[model samples]
Target chain A: MSVVSDRVTALVPSQWWQRSHELLSRVFEDDRRLLALCLTPALALYVLVAILPMVWAFNLSLYEVSTLNPVWEWTGPGRLLDIVASGTFQAAFGRSLVFGFGSVAFQIVVGVSLALLVNREFKGAVLARALALLPYMVPAVAIGMVGQFMLNAQYGIINLVLIRVGILNNPVAFLGLPETAMATVMVVGSWKFAVFVTLLTLARLQSIPENFYEGATMCGANAYQKFRDVTLPRIKNVILIAALLRTLWMFNKFDIIYIMTRGGPGETTTTIPLHAYEVAFNQYRLGEAAGIAALMFVFLALWSIVYFRVARPEEEVRVA
Target chain B: MTDIQVDTLRKEFSSDGGEIVAVDDVSFTVEDGEFVCIVGPSGCGKTTLLRCIAGLEHPTSGEITLGGEAVTDVPPQNRNLAFVFQDITLYPHMKVWENIAYPLKLDGVGADTRYERAQEVADTIQIGELLDKYPGELSGGQQQRVAIGRSIIRSPRAYLLDEPMSDLDAKLKKEMRVELQRIQQQVGGTMVYVTHDQEEAMTLSDRMIVMDDGEIQQFGSPQRVYHEPNNVFVSQFIGSPEINLLPATCRDGATVAVDDTDWRVDTGVDADSVPESVTLGFRPRHTTVERTADPDGIGGEVALVEAVGDENILYIDSEVGELRAVADIEQNPIEEGDSVAIGVERAYLFDAETGETVATSRRHGDRSEDQVEA
Candidate 1:
């Protein structure tokens, strides 16, 4: 009985050999390992420039760092709690939500309207479509400077036109005022992103089958009925995907807002990204900045999961 | 039910190359509850004519009256005509029942009634089990049945079927032909069917119109069209294996010379009335095969024999031209290369210049003879 058991045991691979074989096969068959080998240097550079700094900022957020001493001390979540309870951070957070949602709504409405206008064949449609995308292509810094010059209270073109037309007795201080600063940011953001939405909606519109419309017509559906029954349902999934993508992109937008409002005359246009930058570099409160960075990371991660769930159908079809 | 009358309809399309006349001066009338089958070759404007009747297309010059009211500007939905396209244009997204009930729903019929009617039609077409299945999930024949049911449920002024069974397999097509005829009879609705298959036209139509090059060649009962073609084209286009047209010179009243051989025909044309040069058209079944070595009889060497179950088609190479003769399978086992004589019992004499029948008087006499024989 012992000899037979020994013989059966001998047929099985030894533990060390099995482990080595598995390791080798895993290295051979694993796609992630292959990808990592190809992209390791670029990924490392990205981590160093972007991700590692974010991590360092998060670590510092848990510590009390003074710019004068250039030394840090562990403070845990106390600073984060204090910042959350403060009025300034709360106002900034509230304003960011308004800015994001307001801009996105405006962009979607205007963009869809523009897309519908150019969807049909018309005279000069090509030229009009090209011109519509020009605003999105302008450099963010240049747009900001130009906007500031145009809206300048003293002698800006907008003020000059208003004064000359007798619409205003005096030049309006547009950007300097609290009520108008956030509105200005939203308008600027919408101007930059509306073109993106238009392009996306146009592409989706073009992909709808012409036969569906013909079928609707044959079924005695009028124009509005056809759009409601056929066109809307057919493009619903694409619109959802476009909206989700735009949401993510708009949520993290920094350059347009920073260049335009610089966190506003009051903190009216200070989004989470602008707030983080101010805390870290401007105030030199690395620890608090790191905490804010980590919070922003969590918010973006939640958003990404929601976006993936919403946009999965489009991605799946593209993969197929 | 309303009768349809199309008066001198004409339609021309402006193509990139030039103008194309799709339908030229076509005129026909479908009496109430009549089944008219339009038979033509592909691209011969049969479908274009049906579309005009359905109000899917407007004639460039002409008027269509339904129930004595001009319907030139009426839309398809208002025309009360249901069309079954050749491609089985069932809505892929809709279930079989939904597709059938679509017309009822469009007319704002109640759900309970539409559902009951859809079920009845589904059962009629033997697609009751597939009522809940989307069109994409159904087979080609099932989809075609659904399309037919959709048209039938409307009970419109007329049902226009454009080669609806052309996409089905041979066995299915034969089955559907019988089913369509049965349904048309049961419904007692005006039906205008279009097909290139003469056999289908013969089986389904109360009256069949043979068209060619956007022109109506002949229109009459299928039996009349088959037995008495108005021109050589109708005679050739309407029969399987096609009718044999042999070049002949009318030598006298009772005879025509086919090549060097003098074949006796019962054309009944007087010597003066017979054209000098004419075409002798006879169907394959009309040409009888005899084991004769007579020099005066038309002679041919058998080229091939096609045994089609009940009959044998003998392809013979004659001096007049190649001819086919259908014979009983049990008799006349003439093999290839065998010399034989083919005799014409009755043949059509068509004027070579105009292709019009020169032997109409003979056809009239034959009809009376046939009646007396019956």
Candidate 2:
């Protein structure tokens, strides 16, 4: 036993390391124990960064708190419930639905179309595919700033080109009007992120074997029919997963909207996240903002559950 | 069903490296309701030729006609041809019945009618029970059956199969080969099949097109190709153990000196037309081997013996080259490490420089019984 221990010690440079290594080996012999050990670091990080904040916010929602003064007044669920039922929160929720779902749908359609276009075999196709994903790498702040400059009614190049092309007789203040502010914000906000869908959809598209199309052709399927049978079913799962991720991100997206419209044009573009921000900083109502954030979290969790149940996005795409 | 006529079809693919001539001025004709197979080594343009006929590939300079209707510029779907790929490409998301009914669905057939036709096809191909299962759940042979069922369901003008059975195991391949032949006869559709396996081509096709280097080496019945190979490549390619080839020189009208000059095979050609240097060819089944103390004939040692059912395939290491000879195991029990003498009862002489056939000992029309051994 002494010799065996000595050999084990010699395998490692230090006695403490050897003892720990032996302990790890013994613990890893059980599959459940090994899995728990592997997940400990990530679980700890998630609890600290995500779960703890959510729990703190939920606790804060039940009490009336102010950031200016560190005093908390005991309040029941009445205030939180009242804030949820208020017209401001209802309008913000409706706006978020429009923005989030609209952006996701637009991204999926354009991204899949772009992927299909670039998937063809031609000269410089590889370079074209690489260039197509460049937009996704641009910073959100840069897109917001550039969008503001381009949509400027007086001196923007877009207005100049539109006037020269006779599409628009006059320069329109795109983000300064109530009717166009939300639409403009949505399009600009989703510009850089649409290629996230493209990135994944393109990967799935490339993995599909060329023979599938050839087989479809032999089955008397026209071009649209080929896409419907061969391309769509293969990319359906990918598109669903991409839409789910994009919906979550767009719903919680704060930077681009805050930078472009600032929930502006008479509260036209105020989404749920922006509403929560305004409640905290503008109204100095920390407890109300925490309530809104907590509600958003619960809504997203429920939405994700339903999305998974209905869409059934698979982790691995099967090719036949 | 319509016959296909390919007139001087050629296909060239240009890559970054250079231009590749996949099918170089190939021409052939497939009669109505006939099963013709294009067989060759890999990259020999047999698959390309089949693709050209199916309209999956466009020839660089040629015209293709189906029943005398020119379809050179037609798309694959418009050409009304069914193709079975070598990989057995069945849509994974679709059930077996849906895959068989895909063409009818494309034609706007009602779901009930499509299912009825699919059921008929599935029963015909012996896949009736697998109609509800997806392609991912089926075995390789079952997937192949589903593919074939899909092809025959449409009753297209012709069917082109590109090495369809090449992925199956030996036993499964034989079974599918018979099933395909029966389906072809029942459907009576013009079929153009491509394969690199010579045995598959021989057993399945009514006429076989043997190709090499983007050109047709020979196109005839399997028996004619086996007995009267036009060149060295065809003879060596079509046989199982491969034909035995030895370098020789025709000394005169009657005599042809073999490998070591001491051994001579009698030539059955006229002296004036015979080439000087030639390649003597004989099939392993036709060549005879006996244990001999006298070394007047071509002498060799049996290096290996493969007992294949009733016959033994002997691998002989001779003075000139390694020779393959087949023998009846029960009548002549040959073993490894035995010294033997070989006799060529029938032989073909090919021009050595050009690898073209010059003469054969037996005339083409005279089919008679011959002695098996000397």
Candidate 3:
């Protein structure tokens, strides 16, 4: 199909698409109109599949609907407002703030340390770095299964080990109680996502020249001084972008928490995404679920905009 | 003021599991308030020697003394010295003021004092208006100035610069050479500069060390090193439009026969030390070319003529080999395929096998090493 489109574009020599071509050529050079023409099929497919479903869901949010029986009652945004005022959403929203920020903070701390460790040329450094990427590469379901196995109340490895170590009298119902459930899920979420931040920070670390460290040494900066003066300021932007991305991802993340605690013994671990999923699938409240998802989209968009405005690099962005 | 004395310094680096010696047994002294340049072709241990003195690289087996105190075990930070790297090492995240204030900051200076010193240095470098801009925002030349500013912000015992102006364009490099010399004189501190370009070395240094193959070829004032090169390597490495070499046999104490023509050679050497065949070395400026061949002159055919602003270098294929001779274009008019007679006005005679200097011209004034200072 691409070959056919290429041939067709080559056969047609017209100036009708000049304006849009000029606009695209400003972004990236050469073959602007034909490249845009080639992108049409993928754009159409996305509109049909991903985009159309989101638009349809947004449309459905203004009406009362049920999936169990084919009934659509005209509600005029009343159902959406009702969900917004509901106590379940309020509790879930509070829990999500704890989980999203909490997990993102954990990921940032762990990822930066890991990146710093692996950036040096130590023996077995490559193997150590590759091993650090395991959690991110493993399937979320497998991770959840491992978490369940280790945290089982009756006869789990964690309980047995804690008893032997004498740090805890027992395992203390790790994934089974309201107090520990969210924390447990956050641990699992952070472990899975931290490697991505490490990758980003590591790439940035590699680009920083060796001369900066040498310069600092010649200037009489000790090890700690060098890290504080040279290394930290250089990677500050990467760290900020990494933290922001992790926050965004952690907010929308559902599978790890859902399978690990299933939104917990109470709904203590029910973040906004998990709450929307439970509403749509468990209670068959399609309209309410769509409304919750739409709220999440708007909140994330606003947060991203505010975060960027506060933390964006002050220099004009140039292609590296 | 401090003087640096490096004694038989050696450095070996392992590459791909095999050890290679970078700096061989080398020794030299940089006198206080003097500017010394270590000049050589790339990979000739000039940079390595500078680094060892700066305490950036540890010598395999040797000693370096600053102000008569041995610093073999000192780390870079503990050593009272500053080194400017070849590539600009300005902190990209730092503004020019912060970059220049870095060495003072290491000494735990107060913020007010640090800024004061940084401003003074910036004004000295004529970069006062650029203090607030980040290093990344500055041009390459400006960044280099900031790097140099950082080095000089604190008064170290000596300054070691590793080709700091190598990355600039040619015009900027020429300008900075004179500026660096002026700065050196103003500060009156010992400075050890390393560069691969002989032109920069001769222009900027009070004394120059010509090095090759991890060893010092000659160390003296730029004029002495240029005029009385100790060996063939020094002779060839220190000059532009490279000096010509013709195989000759010593006939007596003052005359050498070159291609059946006798040229006068003066030296302090007794006739007993003179060898039979001496490889003759003479600068291009001393070779005179005439359009007609004579019995007393060496004849050659003109190969190529290169006009370089004020002078022309004629590459002539003569009986000995190809010889490069500097000519005034207006005075000595010749072109390709023109047969010319080459007259030798001045020359040095080195033993053919050992390449050690056997004779030199009386034009060099005196053969004593101290003549470099005179």
Candidate 4:
């Protein structure tokens, strides 16, 4: 232990040794005292907020605890494995995947189309861009409430307009049916996230040198050819980054989904995060909740790895 | 091969400020298989004129007839002309092969023929190994070669190049200029090039149109433009270290008083035509430097000496007011503050007000008999 400690101490730098020697002789040195003063708050915050909670959560995930009797018994990694293998937990995990992928796909399509629409030099384009960003700027809870109001079955504006336009014979319960419920959540999530993607794509489009398109036109390439050959390839990296971020955000989304559907009309909208919340607060199953949280943490870590691998910029890839 | 005849081409851009006349009533003709360079200062509408010929920009009024067919409203692609830009506007996302093959593909050429022709062009521009690389992966010079390759593969009626070599370094520019001339000769197409560099125009063109302020100042062969300029602007713009102009009053017949010195200069104009004030233009090479005691010359102290390795340039503050003279390196050296005499020969005189060349005369002309006392 002493040898290992000495090796670790060597990496702390020579200044630490000098300061330690000085402190041993006197209790303070000017440089060492100043360094301590600067690092104290940051170290305290790290220990209290980051390290303590992580350690506590890790410890809690290894126990069995129930709500009825406020007691816990140590069970090693048994509970973590049990939760991973359970059908309900697996279903919730699949639902989370659906939510993430469904939202990201819709967002990329709508976002790229919207960006292209506003990319041209036309009248009222600025207004269109500002209106498109309204969904992103609204608070998540507000967005959920707005979606609920608009998608309401009886008195909703959407249904009213559809009935008046003769597109529907009866008002549809958009958030009630299981299939339609998941689809509605995905659509709402995408609507909210599309603004960020559009902004990212617009920035990428602006950075592409104008000469590229002009050269394409001069080379006998029409509008579609220019977009396919020049604009798309130039902004592919930015699009990937935007998609990755949207996927991560959609995977962890809770407030919007909770407010809109409350994981109701069955477990159709009960994603992994919603399941974790129900276990921790409603059922008071502390150990199971911690296990769910740990599973979510692992899933996100794997996803991030995949994202980095697939979304790496072209410059990082070797060209043949 | 096809001839390009631009008859009174004019273009006016409507900016928020007002109407900016970019190309104003420009008229010229380029014969089949001939290379013509439109040389001008910046903002003189040289690029606009090239774009007009390429059908990239519409003329406000005028007709561009190619092969006796009016092409005023024709689109660029339909006009069958290719343009090479100064910025080397290669599609950064496309590989060199795709870039060079784009025009052929647009014309519905088969895949095999397109690739084969692209390879042939790639070999011509010496970018065969870089065919698969994207434009962003290549250097500026390589990208420019790819751009040229793209144009040449189309076998367009005429090629419009707007300052294509302006972005290259000095050494590369020189090498590419030689290669470009060779390519033009090999293709034998009517080529219209625009550049601000007179040396490039002189080196590469069969004829050049020198323009300034949206008007053609002179249109002639490079040799004619150099030895006999139509106006003061061409005289100043065509040569390195510009020709020097001195104020002179056309006194009694063919005799002009240059400042306090009297010179017997034949106007070469009709005997009846004499202007009150005329400007005397002489190239630095036309002025000879001599010792201070030499007779039959204007003398002054040397202001500056510029050593250009192969030749030397002496700035003399002589009686004609700061004359620039080019002398051989092997000649006797003249340092700053050294008094020297300059003898002018084969000088041109321009009407001072109009800046138009009035006459040119050799040193020993009929006017020499009216020699005046200094």
Top candidate (TM-score)? 2
Instruction: Give the alpha-carbon lDDT of every model.
Output: 0.79, 0.89, 0.84, 0.83
The sequence of per-residue lDDT tens digits that candidate 3 reaches over residues A139-185 is: 98998889888888887788889889998985678898998888888
DockQ order, best first, reads 2, 3, 4, 1
Task: List, residue by residue over B130-150, the lDDT tens digit for candidate 1.
Answer: 888887787788888888898
> Which number leads on DockQ?
2
Question: Sort by TM-score, best first: what order?
Answer: 2, 3, 4, 1
Question: Across residues A1-320, which tens digit of lDDT does each residue of candidate 1 receive?
Answer: 99998898798768966899999788779999978877999998999999888778778788988788777788887888887887867776777678777888888888877887888777798898888888888887888888888889997898899999999999887888998888877876677678888888888877766644544445555677667655565555666666776766776778878987788887778887899789878998877777776776677789768767766635422110
Question: DockQ for each candidate?
Answer: 0.14, 0.70, 0.39, 0.24
Clashing pairs in 2: none
Q: Encode model 4's per-residue lDDT on A177-254: one tens digit a residue.
A: 887999998898678788899999998887777766766777777788778877887778878888888888888899
TM-score of each: 0.76, 0.95, 0.89, 0.85
Tell me the spans in candidate 1 whose CA falls farther than 4 Å from its real position: A1-215, A255-269, A273-320, B108-113, B258-274, B290-301, B317-322, B360-374
Alpha-carbon runs more than 4 Å astray in model 4: A1-58, A66-70, A123-134, A314-320, B105-115, B132-139, B259-271, B293-299, B319-321, B331-333, B362-374
Alpha-carbon error at A186 in model 3, in Å?
Answer: 1.3
Per-candidate fnat, comma-separated: 0.15, 0.79, 0.58, 0.36
DockQ, candidate 4, vs. native dimer = 0.24
